[model samples]
Target: MIDKFVPSVATALAGVKDGATILVGGFGAVGQPDLLIEGLIEQGAGDLTVVANNAGYGRVGLARLLAAGRVRRLVCSYPRIPGSVIFEDLYRAGRLELELVPQGTLAERLRAAGAGIPAFFTPTGAGTRLVDGKETRRIGTRDYVLEHALHGDVALIEAWQADRWGNLTYRGSSRNFNPVMATAAELTIAQVYHAAPLGALDPEAIVTPGIYVDRIVHHPAGALHA
Candidate 1:
């Protein structure tokens, strides 16, 4: 049998090690997997590198994880949005390391990783400080920089629905970074609002197929407001 359901968030995150790279899915808090993050905090694997769209909001989700001192580095596009106090304090005090990537570039990098492409060129940060120490090439008067694919040891996802086979679906913008992060990680753990019967979901509505997801934890309140 190929059942991927896990009983709890802690079980979903089992085997994650210290010094692991975790891909955190969210566009601000929309698709952020807060319950799994809380479980990760309780699981206590430190010295992590977290990749996300932004630092975090208020003192919840990713922000709380950083404050817990589990994260050694953060790779994000927006390190400073409103209520990202925890990341700011840790960064300013040199307790945290940061790698700022352009939002579009970050998404592409993860996509490329999942697609099995080692590297790609894009014009997003071609002539800026973001491209420093990187290779640049000009094609038809437009300059592009080479970006390496980003792979994760684990990806924490938030889904609207999932099946025992691990197929997943998301609602609205909550789908934002979840799919790409799912495909790019070695072990993908999803916190879903519902665990539907194997054939309950419409085929066309399935946004993330079962092959990319490894574990699913049915959390009824996971995305109530997202």
Candidate 2:
């Protein structure tokens, strides 16, 4: 088996390039990969497009990347949070581009990309501004909007535990987006609290199969800033 572990966060994210599209796994910092984001900040690769559930809040995690002005565009369900002033400021100034999708729609798009589906139609945003300029069709009696699949150059995810082969197990609500995002990217990196032996983790308990994960970094205790 190929060893997927990397010595440090920087090395795990070493291949990320400028102008790359990144799928970030998180829901309000719960599942955010803080160390990976930190490495990205230090890497200083600019003009990135980030896809997540929300813009980073406070001064940590994704917020640090946004504050550094590294992200050129943001695709997410919620861009504004109580303390996301950096994102708001940049967006209002037109320095950052924003694509706001409905929460369910966003999840489906990512899932579709991983499933090899190029696009899918849904009634979620049929009559709203979300469908503006997009193709629309009637199915049965309801109108549905066509949303294209979303894929990324890299995926950053956080998990509670991982085996040597990269099989991942998430803790509680922190599992949000991580599993799906793992399959939607060309390269998938995971930050885990613990690293187990090849067969230590129960096969039935693994949330994300190792085949979808490319790299794993063990996160330091209390590493999360928010």
Candidate 3:
């Protein structure tokens, strides 16, 4: 049997060591997996390099992780927003490191890692501080910079439904970044709302196949966060 369901969040997060790169799936709070993040806080792994769309909002989800001082570095498009005080404070004090990548560039990097593409050229950051020490070249009239694929040791994502086999689906806007992060990580952990039996999900509705997932936890939609 290829069952990957775990009884609790702790079991799903097992073996995540210190200094690991974590691919966090979500666009702001929409698809963000807060229960897993809360569990990770208790799991107590530190010095994490998190790849996400933004720093975090308010004091939940990624913000909570940052406040817990578990993150060593953050790689994202937006490191600051209205309610992102924790990231702002830590970054200003120089207690945290930030890698600011453009939104499109960030997504492509994760996608490239999953697709086995070592590196690629993009015109997004040419002739700017974003490409400061990185290689740049001009093809035709537009300039491009060499961007390497971004891979993760672990990925924490939220799925709307799953089976014991770990195949996944997403709900509405929560699907953002989850699918790509699942493919880009060495170990993908999914927090699912529904634990369906085998063959319960419509085959065409499965967004992430079971082969890419390593663990699954059932955390219902109304369980945590706003």
TM-score to native of every candidate shown = 0.97, 0.97, 0.97
Instruction: For model 2, name the residue pairs that clash.
Output: none
The segments of candidate 1 whose C-alpha lies over 4 angstroms from its true place after superposition are 222-226
Q: Model 3, 1-226: lDDT tens per residue?
A: 8889888898888999999999999999988988889989999999999999999989999999999999999999988888999999999999999999999999999999999999999999898898899999989999999999999999999999999998998989999899999999999999988999999999999999999999998887677621
Clashing pairs for model 1 are none
Specify the poorest-scoring 10-residue window by lDDT in model 1. Answer: 217-226
Worst 10 residues of 2 by lDDT: 217-226
What does the lDDT come to for candidate 2?
Answer: 0.91
C-alpha lDDT values of all predictions: 0.93, 0.91, 0.93
Candidate order by decreasing TM-score: 3, 1, 2
TM-score: model 1 vs. ground truth: 0.97
User: lDDT tens string, model 2, 140-222?
Assistant: 99998989999999999999999878999989999999999999999999999988988899888998999999999987567
Q: Candidate 1's residue-wise lDDT over 1-226, tens digit each?
A: 8899987777898999999999999999899999899999999999999999999989999999999999999999999999999998998999999999999999999999999999999999887898899999999989989999999999999999999999999999999999999999999999999879989999999999999999988888724321
What is the lDDT for 99 in model 1? 96
